[model samples]
Target: MQVELNSVWQVNGVDGLEKALYRVLQLYMKQRVVILFPLSDSKALLRPVKIDFDNFSEAIKVGNARPSRYDLPYYQLQYDDEISREHLTKRDEKYTLIVDLVSNPDFLLSFVERPRSKLVSLHAKTHNTYVQNIYRALNLYWKYAQERNALLPGYKNSGGRGKARVAGEIKRGSPIQLSSSSIEAPKGVNTSESDKELFIKAMKKFGLRGEEVKFSRVYDKMLKEYYAEELISAEAESREAKVPNYRAFIYWVKKLIPTDTLIRKQTNQGDFDRNKRGLRGAATDHTEGPGSCFELDATVLDVHIVSDFQRNHVLGRPTVYCVVDKESRMIVGLHVSLEYASWRAGRQALINSFTSKKEYCAQFDIEIEESEWPCSHIPLRLLCDRGEFICKDAENLAVPLIGHLSIAPPYRAELKGIVEHRFNILNEKLVHELPGTTKGKQYDRSVKDPRLDATFTLREITKLLIDEVLEHNSSIFQDLAKQSILLIESGLSPTPLNYWNQHVKAQRHALSKADEVHVRSRLLPTTKVTMTGKGIRLNDQMYFESDHPDFDAWKIIARNNGSWSLDALVDHDNSSLLYVRLEEEGSFIKCYLKKESANFANRHQADILFFKDWVKLEKNKAKPSAKSIERHNRKKQVIESAIEDTKLEPKVGSKSKRTKGMKARRREAILAQRLEESGAKPDQEYSSVNSEQSSQRIDDDRKKVISILKRKKVTDNET
Candidate 1:
């Protein structure tokens, strides 16, 4: 029978032994074989024997001839080079020692052929280095068919890990020293089962709660409550207590309680889940490539900025929204607005991500090539926190624009860590370095007020943010963990822009082209606007007029009937234009702000709203002022005096008689009043001209009265 080297053969029913297993180590001339026998006893050394192939075959055949027949060609072979090499790599010291000793031909031959004592003598004499346990090394080499890694020390099984020791009569730890020689120090007792129960109860009372208690405080509370008798005695006698020490209490606490449970019990669930949870994977784990997924988040910037319209008026800190690509760590879009961190500001950021950066930068007087900030396509998936993306408006607006919308759980900001981290990067790079930055600690802020140092306007800060984003995209990222084989082979620098460009060049990007107009319409928030006789009105302050043919017809309908309202998508960043949805699907009419609402144009919607609120506040403040009250009282007195004068007038003869020739009476009263005010008599020649003119005016008035009476008579006859 043919036998392979390193294969194990079992000979059962042997003459002297019940069974014997031998590994074929080497094959010599004339079918001679060198084999190793691994004994069942672990303490016994491995036995190596050389025998002829015919004899080995006969022993196997004899075993097959027994009543309880055994297989003739029994072989058990198991050897893995990869596993053995891995084992060797784990223990460098043992592996190196074994390899150095075995490298010598004379030592290796003697180790395998000679007896244990002889091999040890040879090793001691030939080499200056000495192995403490040569027999153990030999046995390991022979047992594993001469594999070097089997000689490694079994340190993993050496220590009695996870095994607890029972407490003995003696004290567990060293005794404490006493300050006074008269008072003897007490030996601390071991933590018994009852003591462990007390410790657990104390921990539950003090340590295991949402409100965090310091370790020392917990120990004090435990001593005061659980070991009050011992503490009192020690205090009265001025000696240490015989109870378990703080060390033993802590050991038992750690042993009995799991780390996860301890942390969970001592922290708020939301804070623990958001800030202290283990991160199993990355945001880019599911992303295919650049543009595959985008993370969106917003934060109030740390720097104060002035209003763009009024530079002297500080607008406070602006809310900045960032959209980051998960794969490349690129800031695909950014928006700085005076609005709060709401969906309104978030949607503007999304719109910036979906549109061309060239035009966006141009608006801020920043010139850059399209290649510098090439991100302009919608991603397959969008991730955001619950603050801005959890509402119905966000769902309605965002669901149609992307393939999937991932709204992270409340208070879990780590889910959108890519964008959250980008906010930090921007703040550190630009915002914190700028003037009027509220970046220092509260105590340190007593030095100077950041608001008083405000210099940049909203537009200026926005431009700086854009510049910073561009610089960040081009800067090298050292912590980039994931890299494709092609990318590495190409030897490209690790920059977000480079990663993006390489992915696009290799056609491995997940960018989807979308019409800018459609994306803008979908991303912008929509509000109900009333179509009035003048124009479409937003928030009862801003009016927009559309030039569409139906606009005039709709205005006429609103004039005759009551005004109707429709949903119009509005960009809060600019109130100059609004997108009014028409009856046709996917059709929107551009509505320009009317001349009446011109004051609101070219300003943010938030700014206009703030101005209106300020106006109302001023009006309310003036209502209770002394000057306003005095003016109101004066007007009331004047009206009452005029009513008293009217009451003093003479009574009229009859209703018809009093009403007769009322126009002539009113002319004569006006003339007398004008003449009395001038205090002058009319000249004779001027009176003649006035008489002629009055006669002509009388003739003209008579003709107008006849025309009106004839017309009224005809209308009454027709009726």
Candidate 2:
């Protein structure tokens, strides 16, 4: 049985558990294995009977009184959580009580359930014996109650008088109701039946115990479906004209936009509307005047043709420059040429347009029925892009006869967008309809495309352009008659020739019949030099003297390939070698030197060295001294020793013998003989003469001593 005597964690108090201790005795003391609860009671165990209290009077009473369950020997298990003098003195005392109050569980019980009397007794032990007597009196009362069994309601005393209270009456506490039915209601509070019912329904719908359904997912799905429906309806509503579909818009953006910023939302509405709107209505009021604005451009043909005269038995194909009048949209000029878009080509086209006879012009002159003056009436402004031809001097495209020409700005394709768009339409509709266009279809399957040979020459590309232009003017008509106004006013014969003649005839300073080569004052300035037959003419002052020795027996071509100064080209009489001016400015300059001229020049000043000789003379000025040569040799030796590990063998095909035949064997034998002569033989051990001599003396001394001893022995024996 475990016994306990209660104490407290604090100084003075009557603990609730300690007040109920005697009642526990009434309930459980009858058992043979009695466990005195130190957690609830500070009862001292004496010799005869248990005091079950810490005070002296209670101990005396318990020692004398006879209780029913006093048969067993008792142990008092008191715990002192704090090391105090009162508790220490009590521990040191020699009472007939076995007190154990040291270990963890015992201390914990006393600490958790300390009684007020025990706390009082602890103070009394230090203060006065009177307080101790009071503690003892309370302890006696506790013992008396335990013997009579007359304690509180929750706990019974030793006698049966406390039994009725333990059964029904209150002891430790006053009469109180703990059951929910017996609880008193607070005043001035009321609840309706409807409110309660509503609260219950709300709890069932959104309570913590059940699964919660989120409406956001459903809302998102509904939004997506709604967006899809709205998009479909928007697309259906916008099906007007030749607008592109959504798929085409995607394709355009994919091809054009940068990958990182290629978001559909970032696309501009203006660009979208423009791309969706296809080509329409070529006519506009922006056309300048009759023959004032000309649209000139070249287009490449899809067809391929052979241009070599021997193979094809055909002249070169032609390039036609079709200049359309801005008002009529009619061809003011059309000419074919072997050159494609070159200055020569464009000049030829311009010349051919104006120079064509009235008879030939009349043949295709449907626009102007019958007029003698025909195209020779009006002044014209030739409009085209800033191509090489349109920007060249008189002999090229700016013939004195041709009118003022205008050039479009660089990369502003929209200025020439009229021609570009027209070309596209022709290719899609008319050009592709031709047999020439379909010729490339056969080479589509070849790994080495046959178009390599069949590709269109510049001539062929020209003819195709001409044919397309002529067909467009004759066959195609404007739906609105006003659209044809520009075409009619642009030319006489409704072609290139009509416009050129009109431009030429209206010229203020027309070309004289004699001057085929126009020498414009603007081209040849007064200060600039010129090339003539006389040679090196500066501002028309000739300087070349063919009779001079420098030019003897030589043909000199006096020409300047457009540099600041004249360049001399003197050819040898008997040889193909040409000598050019080497040092004209009293300074050395590189020139093509004929061997003969070079020899002559050197002979004039025999001792004077040329640049190459001077270079050699400077290099030979400083040579290495003997001491430096010796140091270099020593350094070279060191380098050779460092590199000796490299075993060099000649290549097999080289002049030296590579095979291990007679020559290799002979070389090996010679090397071995040299090694033997040097005393580098593998089996030879080299010892110095000094070490050999010292060892030789020791051996000789041993032989000499033995000889002496033998002689002495012989002598002794004889005696």
Candidate 3:
């Protein structure tokens, strides 16, 4: 910003105006006199003015304010305080500038014609020649101010008197934004200082939060903070640093460090994964029609409820399972249990979702119109998170039952927003509001023993959740209805069942009785068990063909496999039953327990821990004394006699050859009985087995005859 005047220089017209402004630049660039008084005009106009801004103790007011119309003289001299006093006084000085009157003569009358003392007037009667000169003069100084403001250093480009912008033409409303961090890297800098500052700011906004958040959330915070900085300065030179060009830099940094990866590195995989999925899921269109897609997820219900078996023992928090239709947002199926969010909890929830409304409502004894909970059809696609959904057990159950199954990447609940939102509703709107509710956290549980206050048992909690889900599905909300653009267009109200009823396509896939049996069997947890001559040994307990009709076929499968080790499916929820593939029948047969362990309470809600505790309990059981054994047999005999005395004829729903029971039948006679028996018996002796008639078989033939003669029979006449 220096001008070397070797010898003397003179300019004629517009060029002379630029020269005069450049002289002011050279003086200010080398001297810090801005904080001082205005340059004094006691020094001649032809003489250059200089003052040391750092050390000056003098004042000089330099301008020709009083002038006569008769002499050719300058009115206002050049003034550039744009970044001057701000650097000096440390006040709210903005990088703005102003232009003073130049010696140009055309504009001299323009200022005069404005009614101010400038040697002329712009009245209606003023001469045409003077009026024309006024406009020309106004144009000339505007150009001069533009030239002067462009040449100052550290003068940031901005807008208005408020934003301190450069002298220039303006377009419509400002589309370009400005921020300080968007300032260009000063020349000779090796790294992206802007990017570094942005990283620290973004991390401060998001990563500093104790809990792990999603990349989208962090990116959003960064974008918000980025806009708050000073992007473009008021100097014409800095105008080229507009933020429109570098808008992508902040976002690119966020993408470089994915939030999901951060969570995986620093926190629980499940916690991070669930949140990541939720964040990732926000960028989607979930307005699907009913039965097209459904989302399933599990969360620990916020309330503490007692066990159904022991009301005094409070279960910390019951895990809740929900299956929600993407389109209708209906809670189609729900399961609330003490079980953790494993395959079994998700299993029961899936079954409830697909089961008939009549039967499901009967369990809770809730009466409502079938239309109130109409979502019974299986969805074409089933969506779930990575936790249980990624397991083979979950996949096997969902794939065949649903045509398409989607397990979103871990920790991403956003991918399954419908069910997650429903879970939030249950926590905030239902569980947390109830008595005995822990309201989350162990410290929260200590204020009062939820156990002492706990009135809701496991069964009651399930009922409460069921009632809540039912109400939510059937409740009408105008705001919710408006969310579906299609529904709004169609003039439909938003209730879960209503959204489903009006928009669901006719191609809904429903499970038949056979399909339910197939899917239910697949959902069972698989384990390897030894098939011995006695029976299948599981948990050191035996299962015999006599226990259930299914065990008979299951035994045959074991025989076909050389009567050794085989894979069997177990219902952890119902330890009383087991299933094995019947290749000839093209289905699975249900096996009942021949002998149950002492802990096997049929109605007791069971989780994986039940077996773990059972194992531990059995290990420490004391052996019975001789007198206790004798008394046990006597009690068993008395119970048997009582059963025989009070037994009623077992009702016969269908006819089968096994009804004869013992009847003094030979082993061959009983062995020949096979309703679905196909193919020749296996030639290999290991694969073949013959059964003996039971000495104590229940006489179904006598029962069947008596049931037909004197019972509630559906005869044609009665029908």
Candidate 4:
């Protein structure tokens, strides 16, 4: 090995490949790397090492082959120092020198001639003089080839090695002696121009990435066919018969095509685009404090949960929303719902996140101190997928939090590791243990119908989730972040709750009592309503009205004709009372149903539309238990009852005085219409006119009458 001549060079950034800005880094930094080490297909062992200044290798800086990234391969450079490992230079006795030849054009040209492989592969393949001469020529190519200016002026002396025709004496069928200065060229396979075209076309087709049969496989199949072999074999310019083969084709492909270009042809755009974008952000992105980054995500619960109001009403897979702190990886809040992943689901989760966990836990009979779940704070940023993250419900909640909301790329769940991992843990521990667990893709749990195995109601499972989350928050956690340059500054503790207790609680933004109440009231799922003199109507049948201070303010706004449209944030589980936003006072009014007295208190908890339909169906029944009604059967009964209620039984004999003479009037009108349609005008007809036109009109009217009577007679017969 030879080292480069000494030259003074100043160190600079790995050329502005900053990794901090893309991810949330309020408190910590982490980096992940994968490198294709030279001379090996395996990944390199990436680490910082002590190296002698004289032994340091100035890594080859090549122009980027990627069209999208015209800049240097900054990511690949992260592992450039791996080649400078001590063992790479040391042979036990002393350190060996590393060479740098990127600036030498002459060396690059010689390198292209495959000097290393030639030097390593020299062996006698055939007995004889010419073959031995070919070996000597290649041996000479391995050395003294880099001194191009002296030996290959005008690049002519390179011809001696290029054609291996030293002194132009080695020829076909010539029994030449093998000597140091006289050598023959290696045998070159010949192919017809037509076969060359066919080879190129096949290469183009095989270059594209896919799951289909590969180029080598196709070549093997083609070689087995007699007709294909005949088409490829042709007389070359040297009068030698030649054919296209897989090995020669592969060699050409590697010689002509760049690696990325070949990969791009084989795979789709998504593969390269993802690779170039880099899967995870640099560790610096999460250097901020705990409250700075909150990850929100929704996933279907593994276990089945039945409706709260109806025990046996299995709601299938309820969507579960989770909010977690990126810094601590602590689950801050969660919501389990009978609905799908909608804006409402996101709002429910946000409400839980901003509320006091002590009070929230008490609702489920779990005791916890405010200090235990002190994660309540407005995040500087909320990271989520496009699902509910971009919905209006999330937007409304974000307004108060004053945080930046980012949508993670669909494939990058690694960005939201905090919430995503929590969901994984929740399923592994809580949901999988339940009787009706789907247990993911294994199919064993779901094969027998998980719905049939469902034993927990929504309310019961909700309490279970509360208990699980509380346990998770209090449990000790371990930090498994990779060792990196970023980890040197701050030592992140393993326990999320302890870290929150020690530092994040003091630094996080806390919601005031008023702000908490406002957020709690605002984050409930909302439906549009109109503020009318009668009241606010929702779910088609329920009307909300009240004398609450908020309602009074709403009435004032409605009276002033302030646009007329209003929104009601209703509790999905309990539909009795609804909250209306009063922007006038920056407060909410709790409105009770106008017909609350007519329905059972339990009906208030049911979904308004479903409940109202049930109320009408069971209006006169002595027992109106929600559990007794199968959801489908209840819907069927409700629809049938509704139809019956809306049905009008026409009176027999003397319908109503209002409709008494309607039949006779209709009869007369029908007759006049028939006569007028037959070219008879009221203003000119119905008089005793003896004119010829009058007589023609009378005859036409008679014909129309006869036709209409015949049709009516047939209808009557059919009836």
Q: List the candidates' TM-scores in order.
A: 0.65, 0.27, 0.45, 0.49
Top-TM-score structure, candidate number:
1
TM-score pick, better of 1 and 4 = 1
Report RMSD for candidate 2.
54.5
lDDT of 1 at 430: 84
Q: Give one digit per residue, the lDDT tens place, for model 3 in 289-381.
A: 566678888888777776555576666777888898776678888777777887767888877677666555655557767777775667767
- Residue lDDT tens for model 1, 582-629: 554647777899898877766666577777877788788774578888
lDDT of each: 0.75, 0.38, 0.55, 0.55
What's the lDDT for candidate 1?
Answer: 0.75
Clashes of each: 0, 29, 37, 19
lDDT of 2 by residue, 1-719 (tens): 22232211111123222322221221123322212322223456211112223332232344421122221112122234434555455434411011222212243234324543264445445544555443343343233322211111111244665233222222222233357866663221122233234333332333212233232332234324333565466578873222222233333334343443333223344443334334465533554344555566654444444442223322223344545555445454554443467554454344333432243233333233223223222225455666644454633425445456667666554556555665565567555654435432444564554344444533334445545555555543433244333335653444333433443445421222212112112122123233334333321322333323543222243333332343343211111221223224532112333333333221101111223354477799878989999999999998897677444633466445555387547755765676677867533422333356569879999878843444444566677
* Worst window of 10 by summed lDDT in candidate 1: 67-76
Q: Write down the TM-score for model 1.
A: 0.65
What are the RMSD figures for all models against the true structure? 10.2, 54.5, 25.1, 26.4
